[model samples]
Every structure is written in C-alpha cells, then in structure tokens.
Target: MPITEVFKEEMGIGGVLGLLWFQRSWPKYSCQFIEMCLMVTADHGPAVSGAHNTIISARAGKDLVSSLSSGLLTFGDWFGGALDAAAKMFSKAFDSGIISMEFVNKMKKEGKLIMGIGHRVKSINNPDMRVEILKDCQTAFPRHLAARLFTGSGEDHHFKEAKSYPECERFHWRRICGHA
Candidate 1:
C-alpha cells in the first residue's frame, strides 16, 4: 500500500511510516534501519548539498515543501547519494550471486570505488561515533557495515576480512568479559 493509504489510518505518524515500510517487505527489522537513516540524515544539517540547498531555497522565500523538494533534487548520485548507490551496488551484486569479496574485486579490477567502502573523517584509529552507535544495529542492518569500515582504498585483505561483521559482537563480548 502507498503511504497515502497508511496516512488514512488514525495512528501516530511513526506508526504510519513504520507500517508503510513493513508493507513494502524490506528487511525483517526495517523500521529500526529506517529510524537510524532518518536520524543520520536529519543531523547532516546545512553541510550537505540537500540541506544547504534547502536553506538557500528557504532564504529565497520558497515554501517549506518547495524548499525541501529543491534540496532533494540536489541529492543526485554524487552528493548525499551514498545510501542509494550502496543499495544499488549491493543489490546488483546480490542478484548476480556474488560474495562481498567478489564484488570488491570486480570494482577494484574495473577501477571503480565501492560506493560505501570508504570514508574521509572516519578511520580505524579515531573512529566515528555514529558508526559505533550504528554497530549495535548491525544484525538489523548489516549493509551499514559497508560504511563503517574506512579503508584508505579498498585493499584486498581488508575487503576479505570485512566480508561480514564478524568482529562486531566479539569485541563487545570481550569488553563485557573484561578482556578488552
């Protein structure tokens, strides 16, 4: 059903949104993933193209919806576009029955970057708190680990080790057991 059908129900807006997502038959715990994405996108603020454009539009006297749409239009496959790119890449690889390593290799061979495989400010040393927070939801959103592991470039060894989030729970488990 469309969100319009969902909005017809006399329920909380969150409930309506959740129902719409659930109806679309995404992941098992998709609402949590959606919530996380919403929080991240909302906090991006004016630094990103979409939010910056939205600010410009609002300042130029556009209505709220128009400003929002204008901002959205700036979210093409480069700026503010990683989520869509990652999804498309992952889906294509999955549909082709390729493993993560194979997909990484293909991209490397073709001189293409994996859409969600690297980051600028985040790294193994300093780390990103946003990624740390999102790690708890890895079981619900395994796809996001693609964003967390910041390889300077997609090296073969790192990509091999990162085929799955094997260490996510183990690190926390060790810490809990006074082993960290």
Candidate 2:
C-alpha cells in the first residue's frame, strides 16, 4: 500500500505525527505532551558536546550538512545515547518478568549505574523544570503501566528530581512493545 494510504487506514487522516496522536488512544493533549518533550530535549545549548562539535566544524569551513553530521556523530554512549541503552534494559527486564524495583535493585547490586538516572549538576534540591513539566503530563495518563513503573522507580531512587529518565524509558518501552 502507498505510505499515505497506510497512514490514512491506520490513523484515519494524519501522517506520522498523526499516528503518534492515535497511539494508545490518547486524547488531544498527547500532542502537547509530545511537543513539550521535544522542546525540553531540543538542545542544552551551544556548549553541549553535539552543538560544540557542530560549531567547531562550521568554523573550520565545513558545509552545513557536514557540520551537522559531525555534530550528530559526537552523540555516543556518554552523550545522547543513553536513551537506547536504558530502553533496552527496561525492555529486557520487563520481558523477563522482572518488576521495576527488582530490576533497579539488580543493577544497583551489580554496581551498575542507571543510564538515565542522574545528572552531573541537577539534584534533588536543584531539580530540572523540564522534568517537572513531563511529570505533570503523567497525570493525564495515570493508568499507563510504563509511566507508573518508571515514575515509581525514579522516585524511589531520587532520579525524578534530576531528569525524566523514567518517562524516556516508558516511551521506549511503549515503542518496543508496539504500543507506540
């Protein structure tokens, strides 16, 4: 089937974003919730590794696409790649019938750092406002299993104060579980 037809058949009318809109039978507020997530994670600043690399490449006379590619290349495990790793971990645990708390405790027992758990600067006292906004969005989907699991785990470990790692994990889980 044509891509447009497939989208129309699956989502009624909208495109990719429209498909996301219909996922989980979410209400209209889901769009705003997703937009908020995008905005918050859009950019940390020019000082961030990705932006800094892009800027350096541009100043070094690289073309726009090359510069952008150079910046994107810098996003590896330590930079912006933790989301994938965390999602895999969450999925594996869930699939293996391990509860969220048990998974967290297993990681802790192994002396493993939770990928999306902490921030270098932000802490319980100096919380990230973006995280707060996303947490508020959770109120709209109180019965979401992944949301509840991640939120509870994050709060138990104090990661909720630093970042929206739980929400990120929930998003990945939903996608992997075919709910997205």
Q: Model 2, which residues run further than 4 Å from truth?
A: 1-49, 60-64, 99-113, 118-121, 125-180
In model 1, pairs of residues that clash are none
Tens-digit lDDT track of model 1 for 58-149: 99999999999998988875566777888998999999999989998999899776776676346687777776667676655443333334
- Give the top-scoring candidate (TM-score): 1
Indicate the residue-level lDDT of 121 in model 2.
Answer: 57
Per model, how many backbone clashes are there?
0, 0
RMSD (Cα, Å) of model 2: 17.5
Error of 2 at 146 (Å): 47
TM-score of each: 0.34, 0.32
At residue 3, what lDDT does model 2 achieve?
Answer: 68
lDDT of each: 0.62, 0.65
